[model samples]
Target: MTQPHLLYVAWGYPPCRGGGVYRALATANEFARSGWRVTVLTAGRDTFEQYTGTDPSLESQIDPSIDVVRVPFEWPAQDADIRTYSWLRAHLPQVWHRWRAALDTVTFPERGYGPWRAPLERAARRIQETDPVDLVLATANPYVTFAAADALFEEGVPYVLDYRDAWTLDVFSGVTLASHRSRVGRWEDRLIARAREIWFVNAPIRDWHADRYRVHADRMHVVANGWDPELLGGDEPGTETRGAAVSPMTVGDGDRSHPRFGYLGTMTRMVPLAALIDGWELAKRRGSLPPHATLSLAGYLGYFAVPDPEMLATIERGRAIGVSYDGPVPKQDVGDYYSRVDVLVLALGAGRYVTSGKVFEYLATGKPIVSVHDARSAATSVLDGHPLWTATESIDASAIAAALGRGWQLSQTADATQRDAARAYADRFRRDRQLAPRLRVLRDVATTPSESRG
Candidate 1:
């Protein structure tokens, strides 16, 4: 069969360590592996470095057959080093940013990335003209990529949308960020009206969109984010880390001394670090946790790799109570950090739609997990039946402390059987498994007549 030529639009691709980058990377490679000629459209090198720092090591994961095109993107607010800024941007930063935001919206409604529509459209049109694009799959956070897909669709080319994260709906708070009558809502309606498929990472998100736009409900799909088997070790049955469960009574070995609890992944302002720190202190005071139990926050403080003095100060206050910031670990070295920690902290903001990509990685580790977010999270569904999971019913320090105590207990007692079960449960969420059906669906859609898809 002649391979389908797919144009995959993702603003953040390999090297950009943004949360959604892995899914985007996997989508591109998965298409290539499924015998599709994939072209990845993303921001240039400078955008990653100046905004979200790049991970050059991640490039190794991309399939050689796939073509990656880096288009220029300017994010003035993220350029922390004032010296690198132009005169107007340096002198009147607020005015420059306001002007830029206004200019960006001319192409689309999204801020920071709306201006990318023209560049992406031009690139897509040129690529399609050179070698006809069989299908266009655009992933979004900037949502402006929808404009690129819309541009192709205008020329009678069919397109799909990968809603990596919620747009008009605030995922963290599970609230309507913009009404359907609003500008963003109208754009979403117009885009979905023509999309062959609209993919969301979870059912709740997919259902929300489907319900909101019932006229285009059949086009929506749920594509959950799964762990990278290469990074987390492939689905080998009966693995050591596979079925172990955490015991509540015992803490750690006498020789090891300190019981290690680590939170791995981006440490953004939304992470509820203050609550975590306060909870750790509460746990220690209530004798639910050992005095020497170490609470380690490991990973980049923000999307961009720059240090935040204020955030650092927030972490620093925890030092007196056994909390430490271990700094960011690279993607390649992430497994090493996982190996060293006894318990994994799935610290996230409260929301039914907020499921961090890190959760799957935590599941793969088979380590006892302490869910630090509200129990109402959609993540609860994934971790609910797992034997070694401890979750908070609320976001209070007391609830978090209680959850932590349970997690430490689980870590202390969980044997190989429980660990194996945890790993096995995670196996179902391997990236390949999650993407397989999606690829098949895409293939079916690609073969459909353009008019039928429209």
Candidate 2:
């Protein structure tokens, strides 16, 4: 079959450190693997380093076949450097911020990213001028890329909207962020009205969008985030880390002393870090966990170049009780961090739509996972049947502490057969496994073509 060209428009591609980057990377690479001539349209290195923070190592992991085109982008809200600030911003900061917010909405409803529409459309048009783009897969939540894809659709090209996170719905609260009559809502409606497909990270999100856009509900699909085999190592059924992530708990009673537990991901303000620390302290106070048991954390303190002050303080609060914070794991070395830990912590914000990308990686490790988020999270559905996973009955510290104790017990008691079962569960979520069907359908689009709107 002739290789179909895929223009994957994403703002958070490699080096732009965030949870969504992994899925974007995996999706692009998987398309390349499936014989698509892939072109990744994204923001340049400066945008990440100056605003969102960069993971330089992840850039190296992009597929060699994929051609990445970086465009200049900026986020004024995230600019921390004072020298660049105007007199109004430096002195009348609130006034300047409010003015900036209002100004940003002129081009698009998104504050920091509204202006991105022009650049993305220009780039998409430039790319199309060179050769035909068979299908365009645009990801969110700088949903401006969807506008670019919509622009193409107007010119006869079909596009797919990939919502790594929602724009109109507050995934953390399950509330409508903007009413359908609002500009943001109208913009989303226009984008979804004419698309080949729409993809979401979890079922709740898909269902949420489906409820509103009932007319085009059949176009939506759940293309979930899963662990990248290139990083955490592939799931080989007989391998030690395959059946379940690890078998350290099965290493006998003596090895249980001071077991290593770890949480690896961006430590944002939304996550329940305080509750997690409280639970850890309570666990130690009640002799539920060993005094020397280490709870290590690895990743950024927040999404921006500057860390969240409260998040930093929360990490500090856990220091005295064997909690260690190792900032940012390079993409290549993630497996090493997973290997060093005995248990994985799946701490998240409380929401039915809040499903952490880290959960799939945690499950892939086959380690006993303790859910630190609310029991109501969509993640609970993902981990419900895992042989060695435990969850908080509620988000209370005491409940988290008890869940931790249960997790420790599960790790120690689950035998080889159970561990094998756990690994089998993890296998279902490998990044390729989740994306395979989508690629096949897109392949058909490439060869036979979808109805041309133009």
Candidate 3:
């Protein structure tokens, strides 16, 4: 049988270094692996470096069979070159940015990426014309990519909406981010109604969307993020399985002798970093933590490649305490950092639907996990079974301090049997395991006569 063509519309692809890029890469590669010719449509390389930073290591993991098309994207906010800016932009940055933002929403309700709808739609049409596309998988953040999928749908191509985050619902606050009658809501309703499959990263998000859009409830699929098989040495020469046994200490301050509490991934505004710092201070004052112990944060301070002054100041304040900010590590080196830590801190904002992609990686480590996020966060469910996981019911400084203290104690006392059990719990969540069946189902649905193209 001939292979079906899959056009994946992801704004953030490999080397983009955005939080959801890994999932996008894995999904595209998985389609290719499943005997589908996958083509990824994303922004140019310069956009990632100027805005979100680039990780070349991620590119090495992308399957050679898949073709990636880099579409031009102009993000005025991240363009730092003053010489390239127009006279008005250079003279009045605020006014220029406001105008640019307004211009972005002309094609769609989304900000920063609404204008991309035109180019993305054109790209999709061009690609489909080149080789007829059977299925379209469009991921969101810049939900405007849905426009391209919608375009294809209008012309009779089936599409799936891969939502790494919510659209009309605010994951952080568990509130309606957009009104049901708002422009965004209308767009979402239209998009959902036409989508063959709509995937969310977690149950809460999937449930929220399903409940709101009752017409499309049966189409919703909860595809949770899993640890990258590449990072876990899935195909490496020495390693045989996703959760192969490793030396107790891997790299990066492993020999520090003191208990190390670590947090990995991008340090965004959504992270309760300041509260974590304050809690660490409280732990120190209360003598709950050892003198030599350190709270190490291994990631970028802001969402973008550029440094954020406010975030830097927060890091500096934490430095005064026992907190140390180690800059971002490459995707391949994640395990090394994970293995080095005695205990991992899953510090996140108070959101019932919020679950960071880092949480799965943290679980795979089998190290003691100290949860500093809200008790209601979706991550709590993911970590519920881990033996050495310590969670605080509240985000208060005192509660966080107590949790850290307990995490340190767990790190010191957790037996090898307990650690092995934690690793076993995480083994089921390997990227391939999570994606293979989904891809198979997608393939079946795409080929089914009843689910024919719109």
Candidate 4:
């Protein structure tokens, strides 16, 4: 059979260093592995390398056979890289530029992504004229990717929208999205109605979108994030050598006494850092934790730049509560970091629809997980059956303290059989396994003549 042709639209791709890029790369590669000829349309390398911290290592995850097209992008006022700035911008006051950039985000639903609409629309039209595409898969954040897909749709090209996060609903605030009366809101509503299929990262998000767009529910699907085989399958300790620890006495060889609790991913305002600090303080006050228990956080703060004063204050407060900020850990070193942790802290914002991608990766580590989000969150649904997870009802310090104690207890006595079960549970969330069925559905949609033309 001739492989299906797909034009994938994403603002961040390999080398962009954003969290969503991992899923985009995995999705494109998996589709290619399943007999699809994929062409990825993304922002140019200059934007990725200079704006977002570039990681060439991520490219290794991309299938060399996949065709990727890089188009130029310029986010108004967000050019932190000195090289990208003109003489005027370079000389202009920093405060002035910052204000201009902030204004752009409010002007459109997607911060920094709105201005790229024209260029992206042109790119889509050019791609279609040069080579007819069987389908278009647009992953959103800037949500401007939807505009590009809409261009394709106008030209009778079928497209699917991958909503890594909802465009309309405020996931963190747990509020209804802007209604159709607003300009951007109307844009999203119309685009969604015309999409061939819509994929959300979790069920709650899928349900939310379904409830809003009831007639389009048949086209909506859920494709949760999962573990990458390359990142998960390896020696138990993975890449980290025993000598890498800061102190020898702090940890032991295959011993749980010196437990390291790690939190991996971005440290943003959305996270309940205040509650986390309180919980950490309670853990310290209990005096029951092992003397060597250390909570190490590994990730960036404040988008791509260093955190602001408020974020720094939160970090300082965490230090007061025995939580250490170790800065960002690259994706390549994630497995090594996981190996060092006896327990993982899944601290996140509360909402019925919000499920951060970290939960999937954390589950794959086979360590006891202490969830510091809402018990009713979508993440709980994924971790519910996993024996190693201890979820709390709220981010209250007392609740978190109790959960932390239980997690520590579990870590102290969890046998090899228990660890094996945890690992087995993670096995079910592999990237390929999570994405295969979704690809099949897209394939079916592409072949179905009635729905082939959006």
> Lowest summed lDDT over 10 consecutive residues: which window, candidate 3?
245-254
The best-first sequence of candidates by lDDT reads 2, 3, 1, 4
Clashes of each: 17, 4, 0, 0
Query: Judged by lDDT, which candidate is best?
Result: 2
Full-model lDDT for every candidate: 0.82, 0.84, 0.83, 0.78
Better of 3 and 4 by lDDT: 3
Worst 10 residues of 4 by lDDT: 242-251
lDDT of 2 by residue, 1-454 (tens): 6778999999999888887888898889888877899999999988887787888889888888999999889788778789999999999999999999998879888888888888889999999999779889999978888888998887778899998779889999888998889998898888888888999999999999999999989999998898776676554322345434433222323367777888999988888898899999999899898788889988988877777788888889899998888888888888888888778888898888988899988887777899988777889889999988988888888999998888777767877787788877887787777888988887887777456433
Candidate 4 per-residue lDDT over residues 40-125, each given as its tens digit:
99999888766666667788778878988888997656656678666656787676567566765664556677778878888888
lDDT of 3 by residue, 1-454 (tens): 6688899999999888988888898888778877899999999998888788899898998889989998999887667777799988989988998998888789899778888888899999999898888889999888988899999887788899998779888888788989878999889888998998899988999999888988889999988898765675444312454345332334234443577889988878878888888889998889788877888888877888876778778878978677887888989888777777888999887888998898988887778889999888999898888898989868778998899999888877777798888877887776767777678888876676544444
What value does the lDDT take at residue 246 in candidate 4?
Answer: 17
Error of 3 at 92 (Å): 4.1
- Candidate 4's error at 142, in angstroms? 1.2
lDDT of 1 by residue, 1-454 (tens): 6678899998888888888888898778778878899988888977887777888878887888999988999765666677788888878978998888898787588887777788888998898889888799999887988888888888878898999778888898778988889888899889999888899988889888888899889888878888775554342222454333221122235333478999988878888899889999999999998888998898888767686677899999999999999987778777777777888999998888878889988887877999998677788888888888988878889998999999888887888788878877776777667788878988977777677864
